[model samples]
Target: MQVASNFKVLFIAGFGPIVREPSESRELYCEVLGIPFKEESGGYLHTEALQGAKTFALWPLSQAAHSCFDSDSWPEDIPVPQAWLEFDGDSVEKATANLESRGYRILVRNKQEPWGQTVTRFLSPEGILVGVTFTPSMRKEK
Candidate 1:
């Protein structure tokens, strides 16, 4: 059997530090560290203002569940993730198709997120939420 080529992960698209206690978590990352975060009432802490090569976010578990499974609760079969990582890919569709062909269960595919990213998401063996994505806004000006 011919093996498929490895998916080309361009770079880190985003990093979400999963939080269970939003209020306390916000106090730390936002108040203590002085990370300018636009707090959401729904518990998603985010900012495009952070100066870095990689974007950072404070993601609530409930929000993650809604994004992945379209529900407020995580499926009992899949382990709850402590954090989420999105990897930039050349073609999210092709990468997603390859994963499916290799028997990986895709939770979401080619979903255009509200922030304008085309993503394919799944759970890693270690239970971390992972995504293969193409986010145009994250691209740097040449």
Candidate 2:
């Protein structure tokens, strides 16, 4: 008999809808970001596009932690996560410049990662951490 194996983690999901200094308004995910997310009848967003194998959703951080019980909870005083998105691109520098010009704050400049790939980071208006990277040299090895 063959047993089925569970799908391993494919991506990271950062829950949102948080109550913070600058609330991540629903429009950012629904319209501005153009994520095309699904929502419930009550108008709660179901999920956002991580654009990968891992599924990311939006929920109150406290409530989300409770749903995923048996783990350490988020500290009430600590800053909640800023969402992250990593991408494989041809020119990270160019992308970074374009994004920066568009008003996205550069969290980190385009630098070569220890893994030997070019990467850059930026923050969304809501303080979400987003990134873009390319591993062309590494991909060639494969």
Candidate 3:
């Protein structure tokens, strides 16, 4: 059976683990792995220095919950995600529609973040929080 996709994925915008223990995660990525990450407000740590992914970060669980549900606590009804993966797509709306048509429950649809990325989020079968997004900053010519 062939499944149709309405949107094209341009690239992997970002990938990261959803960190429950910020100190442990920070020590691993920053101290042990030696990945240089800049800490932002609310304990968000990110870097564009990694070669494979456009953006890699230690996304705190609180932030992830806030992004998806506008709250600091993860909803008990949904499984807690272990990691996050974002694919930059040609059209977020088209991808969102395609996902819905295929029976995937979308957590958030085409929500524009404060950082200007337009994203649609859903949980994958493996419990990874996946996002189809259009990120202007990542698309810029380097």
Candidate 4:
């Protein structure tokens, strides 16, 4: 089925590998590759200031689980995602609603994160965790 024309995806906000090992992953992405990710609580490492088509990150699986299901573990029935992708829309709320109306299963709805982002999350058909987010801190200064 075709999605509605109004539900245009403005751009990809973030994309990266979801890792089980934070220290090793941090060594690769932050130390070795020098991606300049700031260390956050619970092994999550990310940077919103990266210059590219998408902000990159090395997110922990446990963190992903917490964000999607409010638990420390991914549900046994659901496939564990290998990666994640977040989209920035003109209006995150509208985008989320649009996706839901189209029969997408929203795992998290308009959840405000501690780092200051409002996000709605779901799993893609391929099991990648997807987020529709409005993160003011990530906005480039005009």
Q: Count residue pairs with overlapping backbones in model 4.
A: 0
Best by the TM-score measure:
3
Clashes of each: 0, 0, 0, 0
* lDDT of each residue in 1-142, candidate 3, tens digit only: 3546867666777667766678756764565335689889999999987656676678999999999999999999999988887878678998888778767789999999989999999886557888888999888687
- For all predictions, the C-alpha RMSD in Å is 16.7, 9.9, 16.3, 16.8
Instruction: Estimate the TM-score of every prediction.
Output: 0.61, 0.45, 0.63, 0.61
* Candidate order by decreasing lDDT: 3, 1, 4, 2
- Cα lDDT of model 2 by residue, 75-98, tens digit: 454344555445565778877777
Over 4 Å off in model 2, which ranges? 1-80, 137-142
Query: Over 4 Å off in model 3, which ranges?
Result: 1-51
Candidate 4 residue-wise lDDT, 1-142, digit = tens: 5777878666766667766566655554454334577777886777887655556678999989988888999999887877787766557788777767767678899999998899998765555687878888888899
lDDT by residue for model 1 (25-65), tens: 56545643356877678878788875444665788898899
Residue 9's lDDT in candidate 3: 64
lDDT values, one for every candidate: 0.74, 0.55, 0.81, 0.74
Choose the strongest candidate by lDDT: 3
Q: Candidate 4: where is the Cα deviation over 4 Å?
A: 1-54
